[model samples]
Target: MLTKNRAASFWNGVRMRTLAASPDPDEPPRMVTVPADWDQDAGAAFAAMAPGTGRASLADASMLWVGPLADHPQASHGLATRLLDLLLRRAAAPLPAVWHGLRGSAPGFVLNLAAFAQPEGGLEIDDFVQACETLAEAMHLLQPSGQTPCSLLLSNLDACLAALGLDYDSDPARAVAACLCALATTAMHPHSVPSRPGASAGSVPPASPVPGLTRFALARWQEAALRGRRSGRSPTHELLPETGPIETGLTAPGHALASWTDALLGVEACGAAPLFSPLRPDGRLAASTLARLAARGMSPEAALAASLAGNPVVAIAGPAATETMHRAITPFLDRAPEAPTEVQAPMRAAAGGGRRELPARRSGFTQKATVGGHAIYLRTGEYEDGRLGELSIAPARGSPVQRGLLEAVSQAVSLGLQHGVPLESYVETFAYARLGPGGAVEGDEAVGSATSTLDYVFRTLAHAYLGRSLPDQPQNAVPAEEPDDALLPLDLPRETHRPSGPRRRHGLRLVG
Candidate 1:
């Protein structure tokens, strides 16, 4: 704690000085240059909003972040000092409507800022607009040939990976890919950075004149994106050329940062959201401070800035450019559920596949159970070793949404079983679940009137797999040896059979 305070005191002062000295560009840079005063403006605003008591407040958090950042390898990318300037400032700012409803941002959930594009503190709309142009130029792939700052950077990274004998396609190599992009965002000057049109360094702008993303703004942005894409048609040289990854020139922190970068980003980095969460997206560092940044630290501005390095990384591109990256990244930013199999598959593939192996299982066992007076078919897949591998539950007849939910639950259960979970664990979770339809069961003697379908299915599984006896329902408790069907008239649909397939699959098409 003492070292943290001292370091915080020192680095906070460093940021104030560095940003204090950098005057805003009066005109566009001869080449792409990060706005000099952005740090100063952001820093000053932070002091106003997240002001610490006495001499300790501002610098304390700054130091808290920088001390560990200074130990990473990417620090040389001009990050620690600038990022300290950005994150501290933005964290002090309010969360946007897009991010307003987050459940929480602790170690559990990966914070995602989707729903709409969010413009955070310390950046001008014009500057942000310019970034969109650059991003769109580099990302749009309308034609086969072109040189975008992004494409060139990718090409350079490709060369680096080849020279280093690293595989660009490898999971470990993704961090390297993302780092290269961050470097380029810094090195490439914005095509044009107009003089200030808003408040100065340290001041907040007036409430937006237009509340939401207006049609005019969207159209202008689209045009800019088109121009950017056209320019990158053949890899223009206007942007500065970077030769390789942070191979040698990095300082110690820069090295550590680089190491973390590799560890953090990858096919798994999509963890910016739920479907693509990594166990430790920010890189599980040995140090407590870095660990906090990785596990507890959540900032959209910082996320954008770190991704961009020179600025911040919010999504952008041509017509599809922004959304594609967003669609790719959205699922990753938010935290996924504790149940691994509960994720949306499309998102996982889009963000990049999960880090852990999701082994496939087919129980080879199909059982019929009744819930809510509706028949449900529970199919289980097991591993060759006889452990449950996967599950599927289809209602004899129901809406797609209903069937989808059942299928999702079964899959989640199957995943748990295959991953070394005991049937008892599942029983503890799902037994007596109280939602959806619940009623008397005509078959499956272990259950009587289930409170919910999940209740009946789970209890049945417990009896069939775990050798545990079913709990007695006061109204219809019967000995295990008795046939539950005896309680019902023989005319009712039997729970033992699947309803005819054609009609079961042909229910309502679109009614909600």
Candidate 2:
């Protein structure tokens, strides 16, 4: 058993078992290398399929990427190459089937291919311009009708064209700009009646007078004199030579002067975009033009507010909530503006003949009293644990008018809540009522009275039970009083006595 040959055989068997039980330590891991030329080839293929680009080269490259030749070391290499091929093919052919395929695939590859198709520094000016045009055309063809996809492609195209210093006069940039403007116009004026059935196909106006394809465009055109000023270049004459002559309708002499004044003021407020911003420095509208629109009764603040409030689902509940909120609060300035302040209640009683109920709770202890030109309503009731409740509303503590207004507001809120209206909807309705035409009088009197009553009830309950302190009432405290004539009568259930425990003694005497 101890022989050298026998021992060597035994060691060999142990080694074999160990090797089978665990992974090999001696063997190196298999190495893989992805071809660096893959991205370049894919990019070339995509470029070829672009409009004004070589379609044949694109097709050939796409076939090579997707075929057996694409069996590269990197697993993603084949997929990436194939996607580029498909993108180029789609750009060239643009069939509905290809569009469906694109919708299902990763957007990253398509975006990358678009980026690659843009002109690089190494490309000659003519070649670069041609590539830019082709890329623009492809992007225009692929632009989605739905908002999300359209926004993505629109943003990409804007960036690419801007980098190349392409203007709206250029084929692709102009085409793409037209599409974006259509989207913006649709968003702004969805209910706009079409001029004619088929004539409205490509008739979307830009958001503002400026073709703000990007944030930079907005910045560039925000100011008055600086709007068309780009590196001392006159944008109107150089970039947008097609801009038609400004047409002014006949107006009264006084109105025209006022309009000019308004325009001058607007030009002073906003400024131009910074140099660092990414946008094409062209297509800005003049401040004077915007002023004219304002003179025609176009309130920017009101328009923005309407836009914010119109979309019940998305702008309110979705990603645009914050933006909507900003729009809703935007302010406007008008000549001879009145000072902003809360409404004051008049001393005269409302027109109603009937002796209205006092805007106070029906709690058994307090009373309504008038003091210092204001009404003060006191209330008392039982709290959650049978504790005493007390509360008071002294409208005259600040201003008699303000007190009355507050009382009315409180009443309206309570009545609306009691009627099962949602809090938000009720608030919006109330705000509208106060601000809308022929609504002020109704809100101040009738609506206010109802809300005041509700406020009294809620305050009485809240003070009696919900407040922090829970001290017992004094023994000699004033006795409970009867409810006011205006208040609705409450019917309380009668208390009955009950045994606390079983009467064992009645059945049998227990001996301990």
How high is the CA lDDT of each candidate model?
0.35, 0.26
- Cα-lDDT of candidate 1: 0.35
lDDT of 2 by residue, 420-489 (tens): 3344443334322222111111111112221233333332333334442212223233444553333323
- Identify the runs in model 1 with alpha carbons over 4 angstroms from their true place: 1-363, 443-448, 476-512
Q: Report the error of model 2 at residue 44, Å.
A: 21
Residue 458, model 1: lDDT of: 78
Task: Say which candidate scores most in TM-score.
Answer: 1
Winning model by lDDT: 1
TM-score of 1: 0.26
- CA shift of 233, model 2, Å: 46
Residue range 1-512, candidate 1, lDDT tens digits: 00111121233433322222111223221111112222332333232223222232334543453455456543344444443443333211121110122122110001111111222221133433333233222222111122311221111222232222233333333333233222223223232111122213221111222233233343442343345566563212233223111101111111211211211111111121111111121223212122223333545445546645633221111111212222321121111112222254554565465333323211245456666567776655445565555555666444436755775676566545544567788788877777687788855787777777888887877776667777745444433454345555566654666566432432323233
RMSD of candidates 1 onward, in order: 24.4, 27.2
In angstroms, give how far residue 151 of model 1 lies from its true place: 28
